[model samples]
Target chain A: AQSVAQPEDQVNVAEGNPLTVKCTYSVSGNPYLFWYVQYPNRGLQFLLKYITGDNLVKGSYGFEAEFNKSQTSFHLKKPSALVSDSALYFCAPPSNDYKLSFGAGTTVTVRA
Target chain B: EADIYQTPRYLVIGTGKKITLECSQTMGHDKMYWYQQDPGMELHLIHYSYGVNSTEKGDLSSESTVSRIRTEHFPLTLESARPSHTSQYLCASSEVYSSGGAETQYFGPGTRLLVL
Candidate 1:
């Protein structure tokens, strides 16, 4: 069984500042990791994924994630935050059988 | 536009009432899934279908039942609604890759249900 953890419940950052949302995972085999974002009252939208080869993956809305094997972490990062970037983010690990095990989610609030 | 749609964006019903949540995709994807989520919580997959008539239960134990009668439709039904079942239901669909590897899922707008 695979599991994911997002240590932060909420991350607040000033607009134009760099931001990071932490995520870690435990899986049996090679891991397939994903990042998703949800706006208020909406379903999750895929942001990025790390399947293999690349350690740093870039995604939509100028978001990126770094996959660190040694730390067992895949933290989401953005060079500069925007107020429009405020949303709930989730990190997920792929199940052996193609399902996804999601983290508890982290809400990002970009203050102006 | 290719899209996945979930009907009854907001539903409020009494406990013990039977209800069905409708989901459909026009993307011609062969895989469909249903997930339950509470506000500010993780998503739990309740059911999934690989294709028409191939529904399967997911990791989470759910009281709801689902069916895939058509390639584009997957509907979830609850025989008896309860307060515990009050949550946002998300519908998603994905195209299966021949390589037997990872695939990205496209999600609908989601349906919010409240059981009174």
Candidate 2:
């Protein structure tokens, strides 16, 4: 089963500062990558996805992820983060048959 | 926001009680999924359905069972709830392409279950 790995358990960033959350996946051909965010007491929301072409995939809330095939990485980045961006983020790659294998998640805390 | 919906956004129940988590989507998506997630943790897929009457177990070994009798509804049931079963249940739906691959999944407000 293919899976994604998030090296960071938590990330702290000052509001208005740049933020990045890193993820790597176990490779299996051309993979589809996804990023989802979960706010407190809510379900996971779709952030963005990478299927093919364009290495830089942009998604909701001013977030973008760079897909690096050589590094097997998909890193989510934001030029400036807001306090409202504090949430749990997940990087996922679909396993065979289209089931998502999610990473252990990274909690982003943007403080003022 | 996705049209997917989950009922009883929060539930607190006693051990041994039977509980059902209801999920419905207005998107008419062919692929639906149920995932178990602890607070601020990773998501574990428990069940998924390709379409009506096509339920499949996911990588996680869950005590809960799900049924897909209709394209719009997929409900998960725990015959006897336990403290271990206390967690958030998320419902998601996605459209299937011609190649049988799925696109991005849209989720509903998860149902949080607490069994004491």
For this target, which candidate reaches the highest TM-score against the unseen true structure? Answer: 2
lDDT, residue A92, model 2: 86
lDDT of each: 0.90, 0.90
DockQ of 2: 0.70
Per-residue C-alpha lDDT of model 1 across residues A17-77, encoded as one tens digit per residue: 9999999988777788889999888888999998888899999999999999999999999
User: What tens digits encode model 1's per-residue C-alpha lDDT throughout B38-64?
Assistant: 987888899999998899998789999
- Please give, for residues B3-78, the per-residue lDDT of candidate 2 as tens digits: 9999999999999999999999999898999999888777889999999999999989999999998999999999
lDDT of 2: 0.90
lDDT of 2 by residue, A1-112 (tens): 4678999999999999999999988876777889999998888899999888899999999999999988999999999999999999999888778777776799999999
Best candidate according to DockQ: 2
Per-prediction CA RMSD (Å): 1.7, 1.3
